[model samples]
Target: MDELGIIEQGVDWRTRLGQDIRDCMINDILFSLQTKLQSTSTTLIDLQKVAARIEERIHTIASDYGDYLRRICLTRGDLDSYDVLLNDCQRQQASIRSSILLHQENKQGDQIVQAKRNTMGTSSSSVLSNQVALNDHKEHSHPYEKDMISKLPNDLVQHIMSFLSMREAVRTSVLSHWWVNQWTFLKSIQLNIYWFHMDREKFSSFLDKLLLSRVQADAPMDTFELKSFAIDRANCWINHAIKHNAKVLKFAEYGKWEPFYLDPNLVELSSRYLETLELTNVALDATIFSQLANSCPALQNMLLTDCLLEVEEISSSSLKNLDIIDCYILKDLSICTPSLVSLCIKNERTDNSSFRNSYLIFATVIIIDASSVSSMELLAMDRQFTFVEKDGGEPMFNNLRNLSLGLWCINNMFSPLRRFVRHSPMLRMVTLRISPLDWKSHLTKEHQEMLISIRDRRGLILYIDWY
Candidate 1:
């Protein structure tokens, strides 16, 4: 053999020996990692068992404490303190359980990564080849794993898509062929212009296409929500939603100067199946309330936030829940909803001094007929607003059970608060929330006397919250 051939053979032999040594080292490291992982898994299982036992013990202790509380006569404050402690214990148990679950997931993930590393190794060439082989194996053997969501029933998938916003749901069409038309069948559609990363023209065009597709599909909308900054085509979209028999309608326009106003014709069309109406930063016509009362028999809940209300009365027979938050009332508004079980009116605008001043100046009085209202919250935390009867007669609340009032509203020598407590025959609880600023103000002897008088009433609980 030639000298060059002999040298080449020696070099090849050395290279093979080096590769064998490296492989042996890698095998030893893998074996050590596997042993440590098995030990860690065992420890985790033991820790999980301990956590379960601790949780069981916590439940037992809570039950024992609850029984002790029931056996002994305790003040409302003491009972509340005990309740808070019990809640903290329950929260701790939840935290421990969540930690255990997270540890289990992390352990499983680490095992998966270790197994992959053992199979692929540290060599770049081998890692790439193994990855390709793994991909091919997954594609051939576990084809369903690539598109597991598509395996679900059409109705189930559409129901899941309903939770996503209209833009997000539409984007899912790009995921797979099965998801292409799933968004069209969504019962709930929420369109927020801010979510769409497009210019006004594109957004409008996209919205038009989306609504047209739904219309063509003849899909019935259970809920339709539109949030935008004063879109010109809002009325058209609302008309489409109503045409599709939307049960819940939410329209919020962010333009403070030029708020979106509901079309009277669209309102009438929506009244047939409209169970809930939520309007934010919208301007209402003077006769909007009357129209809703007369036309919308299915309307059960209505929420108005930062809206411009140019109405005198809000009379709804079918309305069950009403929330009026920081709305601009042009005149004194009277609420006479016979079927209203819950009514919450909150005006807390400390940040916007200008809006607060305007709201206080323009929105003067709110007359409420709480004859059928079981739960009522009248909170004007930033300012004091008095609620009185229009006829100057004693206000009677026949079904007023739970009343929550802000300190500003009830701090006027407790005059309004006293009237409510006196007239509410079925009153069970009154929750008074005091702001930090108001907490500094000392209560007068008259205020204390009225508070004692109200608290001394039988079957009625007065809870004060200094927040």
Candidate 2:
């Protein structure tokens, strides 16, 4: 036999077949890697397109509704929803960018493996060893190359986490060892039922664990905002926040029928650092308000919306801004804050006639003692304008500079405007927001003539808003 024939006969047929099968498997794997690379590239392109569209939409919203958005944010504090959307978009973009980088690295790895297979004579074991070594080296040298956010400073990462809801913030712990427990240091703790997506029991347990963990960590609680269904542990959470010297405390109940009542003992707890207190759909008694007025010396801003107030008076010395909207007052309401700078009272009722009759015939009168109030807005369109000064001697708003009134009848608007101008010497602008239900009365020739006469005679700036 010839030399090649003798060599072929010396090699076992089964071994040769095994080697052929191994080579074919390696080729298949390389082909699969190439296909994956192409797929990843396509996915990257699609993600880029999605990201570009999202950016365009965001820009359009900002440009088209900037003023309207500002108004809403200033009046209702609804900016958190918009912020959540923006943060989610940003997180998606970051994840897509990281995925693209990881795919490119994987493609490079595939190219290296293919090059090795071509030059190294298809020794599968040797090729895999080399690839493993290369991967290990890259992993050790640049662990966070794919995830750039991991390389950010801890404080910046914590700041980013602050914008996320409590559940989302806690979920970051599973990303890697470096992220473990990083969310525990967040200053702003926002717990909303919509974020948890859990039953009441699970939510309560999670909340307890989260709060306990933060309390153990001694994390600074700058803002503690809670929006949820009425829970029994809510009082405990509020006490914890107060104990931690929370600066801003907001508690809103989502259930309209089952209103959350503040624990009377909470008012006894001294919140020396509490600057803002906002309560919605909560029931409050007179003793709680009286205690809060005395206990929280730093309290400057207070907002109560859709609340059940069994209190006759709200007295606070350090309050700067107060807003009471659509609250059910069981008796005559009195506000006697001395340091108040701005006050807004708004009530939007469905049955205007009945509400007007009930409100007026109940002999309920709103008394104000805020002499330092500069800006005032009273928007109870159904009720007649009546405000009694505390001592009944001087104008209530001695420092009032701006006044906005929502009037149901434009013909009767002149009297309130004249009275306000007479009482408020520093008042420079009066904005009359005509109620939508009274638009017919707003466009009358007599009303326009009266407005002109008031402006000409009083030398006051009048802005008529028909909405």
Best by lDDT: 2
Q: Identify the runs in model 1 with alpha carbons over 4 angstroms from their true place.
A: 1-168, 175-178, 255-257, 265-270, 353-368, 381-395, 408-412
- Model 1, span 366-415: residue lDDT tens: 54655688998888544344555536565467788999988654556777
What is the per-residue lDDT of model 2 for residues 396-449, given as tens digits with 9 covering 90 to 100?
677999888776335364676666667787887888887555756455777777
Q: Candidate 1: lDDT of 221?
A: 85
What is the model-wide C-alpha lDDT for candidate 1? 0.60
Specify the highest-TM-score model's number.
Answer: 1
Runs of candidate 2 exceeding 4 Å displacement:
1-168, 266-269, 348-365, 382-385, 389-395, 408-414, 436-451
lDDT, candidate 2, at 27: 46
